[model samples]
Target: MVRGAPSGDLSGKTVLVVGANVGIGLEASKHFARMQPARLIIACRSEAKGKVALAEIERETGYNGCEPWIVDLANFASVIAFADKFKREGGDLHILVMNAAIALPVYQPTIDGWETILQVNYLATSLLSLLLIPQLVAAGRKSTVPSRMVIVSSGVLYWLTPAKEIETSLKPLETLGSEEWCIPNHMQSRYSESKLLNLFFVRALTDRLRSVTPLSTIAVTPGFCYSQLRRVWYEKPTFSFVKIVLAIHERLLAWTAEQGSRQLIFAAVGGRDDEENMKGGFVSRGRLVEVADFVLSDEGHRMQDTVWNETIDILSGVSDKISPIVRDYLVVPDSSIN
Candidate 1:
């Protein structure tokens, strides 16, 4: 049985939840608020929506120190601006949850001219994490407390083709503007690629942070939650019955947002000092499951390395000091699958 985390006693800890306007993000913010964190940074695209969420959370949880900040991950300029503003005004961030993602409607280019889904899900998340690493590092150095960076990845990374094929498929999207080249219909490549990118990116960050002392980076999938994002797929009138059936299924198999946030909370502040059990991998239902067996294979690690290099190159362009921690550890891929 999963023991309740040693009380919601975050007290002086400062936690930041990206994409905190709705769904899992909102629930996570509220959960952190209940812990009475020193500060809760609600990063979202809509200031209005974020404010509404913040107010509701404060009211429901009787917790304070919640603030909303605008950030559009699809745009690079906005991500940099948000990070700079946070660096100037926002205090030390002890925990940063990379929870924002986008499943593109069709193939589109972001402001940086990269694929929209990839830009938001991978590139944008990387930039934000890189920009904020100094804060986490500084906090670790100054307070002698552990800090964490958690990326909310997906289980689909293991569901797709072999890692070897991924490398072969990784190439330039010649028709960035063409709907014909869009994903989902074409074997759901876009979504799968973005999820896979998340795994590799987090693994890379984990490796880079090992020697930084007291700081940790972990990646995990939330499992198939019954989120509004899922409802977006059942918009058609004919899918009503199917939606109902799926909704029931989701209710049975998927946990609520609060339940979904448990592992994230655990990753943030659940384990004890002596409990070195839940370090890395995909986690869910308060348990760490092995990712698909192949995910641990050489090809999988190489895939992670490939994406790690690409992510580092992208972030390096933004900040020269940004580096991925490469280390040897008992790192697991999907903690929720096994």
Candidate 2:
């Protein structure tokens, strides 16, 4: 089991967890409540599930700061509405955890044109992060404690290989999102690709925030936890035999939900003194670790830049609600791109 307790206090802070209904997310929410935050907002796709989680958190932790808010990551509009409501009613946002993600064995497109995994895990996650930046900046400026954005990524990203299609183009992001690249046969790769993008986004955003905001952005791997995310494979008919094997493996090797959540809790509250160094860094097993060698290569640097620019461009087209400061930070100058 993972070990370590959350350091410092969150007595009057406001915390938000995007996927708080199950697994590590639910466990993390309970941990946050125990820290005595002023408010703990549980944001998830289903109101019913969120209510159940809210009650469970309160009952387990005996902390009443927990509340449920519905936010669907598959729909950009839903993300916008959730952000808008929080801006209107929420207090200073101290901790923002982007932990909601979906991995599917079958190919499915979201209401947005992108594949389901891509939409929920990367695009919509980006939208919510961008929309909420102003509030994070404000909170950072006024609070003595540093505000943070913890992105839950996966160690699976280490397995990603450069796609042949990506290598053939000067602009890789255009082809990377194509349907041929995101179908079922390639679903595992697609999920790994999304986690890679999460790392890229964290690095880029951390650089942007360093000068203008006190918000520290970092990526973390929970080290192979047992979670509902495995349902994608277990629920498939063709994978029944594989499922049984995996179940046994998980029982033997995977961290419990509570154990898995300790990493995220540590990232949120334990490493305050190292916030500057932690910015844009990756954490695994409670220690800062180097990203994959490919991610540090010249080609990888170019892809990261391309992905960041493409993400901002796509999000800008979808929502005109972005504040000017956020727009300024995200928009790549025409000269720089050219």
Give all candidates' CA lDDT scores: 0.69, 0.81
For every model shown, what is its TM-score relative to the native structure? 0.84, 0.93
Q: How well is each residue in 194-297 modelled by candidate 1, as lDDT tens digits? A: 77667666655555444535666767677677666555557666756646877788878776666666667766665546323344556655555676655576
> Best by lDDT, which number?
2
Please give the lDDT score at residue 203 for candidate 2: 82
Model 1 worst lDDT run, 10 consecutive residues? 324-333
Q: Per-residue CA lDDT of candidate 2, range 1-338, in tens?
A: 46764655688789999999999999999999888889999998988999899989989989998889999999988998998899899967889999999987666877877778888998898889888887877888898766888898888878777685674466555565677766656665777888888988898777555465678888988878899987878767674776888799898999888888888887787677787778788887777889987788777777777787787778878888654655555444232221
Off by over 4 Å in 1: 1-6, 162-165, 169-184, 210-212, 235-248, 274-279, 318-338
Q: How many clashes show up per model?
A: 9, 0
